[model samples]
Target: MQSVAEFDNVGLRYGTDAETLSDISFKLFPGSFYFLTGPSGAGKTSLLKLLYLAHRPSRGAIHMFGQDIVTMPRARLPGFRRRIGVVFQDFRLVPHLSAFDNIALPLRIAGIAERDLLGPVGEMLSWIGLTERADARPATLSGGEQQRVAIARAVIGRPELLVADEPTGNVDPDMAVRLLQLFAALNRLGTTVVVATHDIHLLQEIEGAQMVRLDKGRLSDPTGSLKYPPRPLVLRS
Candidate 1:
């Protein structure tokens, strides 16, 4: 199988703290669905940051489309990033932009004309089930609605790679199912999807979705799995 991205013994660190991620090695196969899971303080977000080229790995190598990202010319990073979509955990919606406009921003950046934006952006809002909220600003919408807008924006452009950080955290169970279905549909169409999440229950929601558990700072399986592992003991004697 072909790989879209590869990380060889990747490690990342903050200013003076210990490495946030260590010895992370994996190949992201083209057109696959991956769920990155771990407890708080785990390196899920850090890993995603590396995936989307937000932060370079502190050590080891990362290759996207067979090019070494660490050594890639800084001027070319935007071109690489244009081939990927990211749904930030923070929801990062522009405070003043309406939901529809926020979802349309990516296309606009890609040079789509304002007059031609309605079809796809409208469809995205409908998929987000927030057509009524289309004109509402992020500050006016509920958390879940804002999240939907963020997701709608991320997936609308249908980039080759989609990296979502805790995408379903703000939504309800049913809406979560809907969002997972949306991702699955996108995956089937050849978009590689990696979702970073803390909700283990989502592991069962998407069939054949590969689960990569980050313990402390290492991957549970380099190949990864969807099956649930034994739950950690929490009750005190």
Candidate 2:
């Protein structure tokens, strides 16, 4: 149970604004499932941003995939990012690409032959029950359908780490369950998963999952203490 990522006294803020996150710390274990839950403005999305390398922490140390990314060269960031898959809350699909092509984009970028991608992309569409919508653009699909396509695209490359932001927000309860199952299936194959959400009911859907709750830019374990860490060090914002 080696960790995929670790944070030590990590904090993030925008400009000189109030600290959005302070002294946050945690470990994301390999092949484990985690639910990052909190109220609005509790920094759930900010945490996801740090996990996926979208933003650097304003202070403290962070490591991912055994590399210290906070200090890693900018030129090498893309290589590290490719090992991780992110399912954004907005379902950031290419507006003009068909569902099949959107799912195929990762493989295409990885230099897989177009012919070699046909089987994998087709199988992903079928798994998401979107084979019929293979030719449909994101703008033409239902919310649930779009979510499925997004999830399909994220996991299609078989990444070692998967970070999803409120992934079930656009779908019904049944579809949420199905999507969670999809993640669970991927976890079985050794993908570490981190899902950020405000939905308490969704937390109950998965037994034995880890809970990392945030309160006003602070970290807490839902099963334990709620005390915010003291901000002893000087912060940027």
RMSD of each: 5.9, 7.3
Clashing pairs in 2: none
As a whole number from 0 to 100, the lDDT of residue 141 in candidate 1 is 96
lDDT by residue (tens digit), candidate 2, 101-210: 99999899989999999999999999889999899999999988999999999999999999999999998988888888888778768788889988888777776566
Tens digit of per-residue lDDT, candidate 1, span 110-196: 899988999999999998899988999999999999999999999988989999999999999889988888888888788888999
Worst 10-residue lDDT window for candidate 1 reads 228-237
The CA lDDT of each predicted structure is 0.86, 0.86
